[model samples]
Target chain A: MKNSPTKNQISSYIIQSQEEEIKRIALELHEGVGQTLYSLYSGLQFIEQTINSSNMKSYVNEMSQLLEKTIQEIRLLSVELHPPTLTTLGLVPAMKSYLRMFTSTYGILVDLDIEGQEPNLTETQKITLFRVCQEALGNVAKYADTHFIQLDFLFVDNNLTMTINDNGKGFTVENEMQRSSGLAAMKERMNLIGGQCLITSEIGKGTTIDVLLPL
Target chain B: MVMDNLYNQTYMKQACEQLQGTIECDFVGLAFQESKGPNIGWKYASGNSNDKYERITLRYGKGIAGRVLSTGRPMEIKYFPQNILGKALEYPIMLAEKLLYAYAVPILINGIPKGVLLVGFRSETSISDDEKKFVEKAAADIKKFLSLEKM
Candidate 1:
């Protein structure tokens, strides 16, 4: 499945497929790998308790440590595969939870202003939009050197709108076109929704992003 | 592993530089999360000229940025000042930034928006389909790198 594309198409196809595959593998890691590993650990613990060979005990202890590390990695993998929050609480709430973590982890204040009752969006819509926002914020956290950030949402008149603004160094859109894929993906999501995306910035003023989606 | 505040500092600054080249606009950045936790909405700039945008925190559905964040989508305004109602006092960031034509993209993690990415052209620059593609690609790529999916 990974090697069927033409040369020019291979990279993009591989990346897309890889991401999808990773999601699948991550899920398997959670549901199957995780359970198997835990069961093994439990079995080993029982063995360690019942049979008291000193050498065997030491070997089992070492294996237990290794298993513990694997378990942690698997958990991480599972989260990556499909964020539990995304499934449990829908897109908006999931982002709220993520923002809490992002704010604390990065020490960046991300003020959220979401208005209008949310209409149920398809899972794909939610994921696509979520992915785009994740990328944009990552750039802000990595590049936008400002102390205040605003995230606003509006669901009015059957149109879904979003905006992100920051007081940081601004750039030229033409120049940005030459570098980076983050912006590209954002636009794709908007287009998929038959929506529009716009970006504005200045040398020392700030940056603002606005998006509108047909509900 | 815990990523220190230094990481945020570095990235925010880097984002400004990157935007300058990528967007061909100017200023960049916004507020950073404080050590104590989330704070009220505010606008903070680290690149270009910082003026009106720094004054107030936008409520959801207000202003260009607010609209995008609130809806969790993207917006394109070929003639920003002309298209929007009132002036900078009403649209402070747009007025201060002197953005005549602007476009914004919402950054969402999980299902909600975490931030926004904006690019503007001075005077009367109409957003092209190609340019829109660029913004979307950049937005998604950045999210993937940030591991927002994990969040």
Candidate 2:
């Protein structure tokens, strides 16, 4: 099941469909509701100026604060659902931006490094790799009780690999692989891209997830 | 919007500090039910080793935290380490944190539980009744905090 073409094709089909759906929802949230909220915020700014009374202005200010949080939340949600940068800016930039956001939002520091030149991969492969990284980071946040996460994307010798490692309380990989859907999903995503995922962990040590794709 | 996040961070820091000091627990966390989803997960944690508390999206009534959310009352587990809490997956925070004794109370706003305040010990010990009361008191303070949000 690791490198089965049939599985890849099927997984690709299913993932493509899901991506389409998620893309649609993300666009709606970003372009549709996001624009509306942006406009609403503009209106509040107008109200803030027009309302001369200090108390009234204070009320407007609070409302504006709340709306701003909502807007940021929507934007974050949209990106999480479908990262526009992954499609437009390519993988390296996408991961950099994502890790920055992850650190800011979750207070988990991540160090990302890229080695060798970027390998040319299809849109499907790129998204698969990005998704795999996302899943790996998520697992680190959930199960790994560590302050630092490390990511490396290397392209060398006609092979592309991404390793996400964290210094957190690690679990037994075999036992967790069977029970954790997140770990399984990361593996499945790699398999769908005709790549292999290797997960290693030890109790009280840390966990490392590696994805290797043949270029 | 950034201000709201800052405020939350400050509040969480204060809450956790006070709660852990009073409850004598190694760690404390707060989780709110998502407005868009029927799930609750940790939003802030003090003395936290990781973000495991933030990663869970518990459905109401599904697990220990969920139970507290559903019942809108305080609950305490005297012993842990794979004890009953629905399933292993449902207790990710406990499994990851290796908490022994735990207590949680609902943060109610206008009589509806909107969030939960959890405090736990890393090593196992019999939880005293006074410790449970401390949790309840912390929960009440949190409830007041939520009420301020309504204002």
How do the residues A144-200 of candidate 1 rate in per-residue lDDT, one tens digit apiece? 666578999899999888888888787777688568677766776667556777877
**Residue-wise lDDT of candidate 2 within B16-132, one digit each (tens)?**
888888767787888885655333567778877666456555445644666787688887766774467554444556655667777888887656666788888888765687877
**Each model's TM-score, in the order given?**
0.46, 0.67
Give DockQ: model 1. 0.02
* Clash pairs, model 2 backbone: none
What local distance difference test score does each model get? Answer: 0.62, 0.75
- Each candidate's clash count: 114, 0
Candidate 2 residue lDDT tens string, A25-137: 98899889999999999999898999989988977875675566567667767777777777777889878877766664445678888899886678888788888888887
What lDDT is reached at residue A25 by model 1?
Answer: 76
Q: After superposition, which runs of candidate 1 have C-alpha atoms over 4 Å from their true positions? A: A1-22, A34-81, B1-151
